[model samples]
Target: MHGPAESGWLLAALCAGTGAYCLLRMRSGVEEQRRTAGGEALMGFGMAAMAVPAAVFAPPAWAWGGYAALFGAVALRALWAARTGAHHLHHLVGALAMVYMAVVMAGTPAGGHAHGTGIPLLTDGLLLYFAGYVLLAGARLVPVPAVAGASGAKGWGDRPELARACRLSMGIAMVAMLLTM
Candidate 1:
């Protein structure tokens, strides 16, 4: 098995790159309703960065701190969104996964826990959560008709490209997570 330290670095890199991409997409979806989705993506990206590094590489002092901050921020935003607007169960669960990851990372030792049992179970949980999130995000894309006289093509969802990006990035992250696990 590849060492945890190596995995941590890989996860961190994946999170950073994916998160940046999500941020870019968020910029394109500037509407308030759409912006929330972008924020959800950002939460995943940030949590992935914090959690994956701790899971794969040498756990560092600041790792949990970052994770905690990401978790708290997302959790609060999710709650606020839920209270005042359309709340998605998938988003809530995804946010919960981030919180769970933070807790797991905080409890794990620096070099990581014993393999085959404790660590594997936790990793499995993370993998499952990420995989589910990918599915949820992908499912958000639904077919929509084009305007009869509109110049551009009609399709499902406001931005198929952005939805595709979210799915691709999350899918890759899920794969990376499973492999690392």
Candidate 2:
């Protein structure tokens, strides 16, 4: 059986692993556009790490602070993305949860077990939202015939296969995180 600490670590690993995979896929996309989504995904993993450990072993202040910072950053990024018309439904949900977590954490006291009622709900919601978004991303893929590259480079541009893999892994990771939370 896994302890709470182990669960937390697992959640963090899932987030980090999926985010890294997505980053790699994004790197191979057309024009090699930087995937801020991957960065956000990694940030989520970081937040999960901090929140879970704090909930299990640390004081409320530490837990709440970690949650607050994570959500605060996400909220800001979401707002910027929304304003730029680059927002996706998944990002919007993630942003909302982050903002909510930040506010809740800000209001609660530190070092208390009785005050973590909202954590589970937040985790579940985030999981579903992110998972849904990952599916949507996969469904939206318009395959490119060949991977673009220079001088017969092994790695080429726009690998839809990679993107699909990234999405699947990310979805599974999010599901795992939610269960652990």
Candidate 3:
């Protein structure tokens, strides 16, 4: 099993890289891409804040509350925006997940508790959900055979596909975090 410290660094690197990629896509001059980039960047930074080594930056009790509040607000915004697009619904789910993690982590003791591999209902269910999502999203991101005369050409930071990859990356990172908790 990997230690929290090691996993923390790994998650940080993964999220940061993913965020940078989203920002790169934002440069495409597409309005939708720019909006998605903003959300992706926020998720990346939020994950980094949650996943960084405790030795380097352990958030105080109040900080966890702050995180919960922030994410809760984001969740509401996403929910409101969901009326227009399915992507917003995904954002709503992501925000709620963050809020859930923040609340659970806040309740945990300072040194943390030992988590068994056995199913614990809620946590384990969430783990399974995220795991399945990551796998499916990753599969979609893979290059597939295109039909003749079809537009298989995708520029940097394309919507839907790139957004899916970013969401998948965040979901994997979130699973890594929940495992350590």
Judging by TM-score against the true structure, name the best candidate: 3
Give all candidates' CA lDDT scores.
Answer: 0.58, 0.55, 0.77
Model 2 error, position 98 (Å): 3.1
RMSD over all Cα atoms, model 2 = 5.4
Error of 1 at 56 (Å): 8.8
Better of 1 and 2 by TM-score: 1
Considering only N, C-alpha and C atoms within 3 Å, which residue pairs clash in candidate 1? 4-56, 4-57, 5-57, 8-56, 8-57, 143-156, 144-156
- Off-target runs (Cα >4 Å) in candidate 2 are 1-5, 22-32, 51-60, 83-87, 102-116, 119-131, 134-158, 175-181
- Residue 173 in model 2: lDDT: 53
Whole-model lDDT, candidate 1? 0.58
User: In what order do the candidates fall by lDDT, top score first?
Assistant: 3, 1, 2
lDDT of 3 by residue, 1-181 (tens): 1246777788899998888887787876688778878887888888888877766666787987999999999899899889999978878877887887787777765646425432367677778878987898888899877668967666786656777877888889878876864
Clashes of each: 7, 5, 0
Q: Pick the candidate with the highest lDDT.
A: 3
Q: What is the lDDT of residue 155 in candidate 2?
A: 49
Local accuracy of candidate 2 as per-residue lDDT tens digits, 53-161: 5455554455556666766676666666666565444555555565555555455445432244456666766777777766777666656565466344434225445
Q: Can you list the residue pairs that collide in candidate 3? A: none
Which candidate do you rate higher for lDDT, 2 or 3?
3
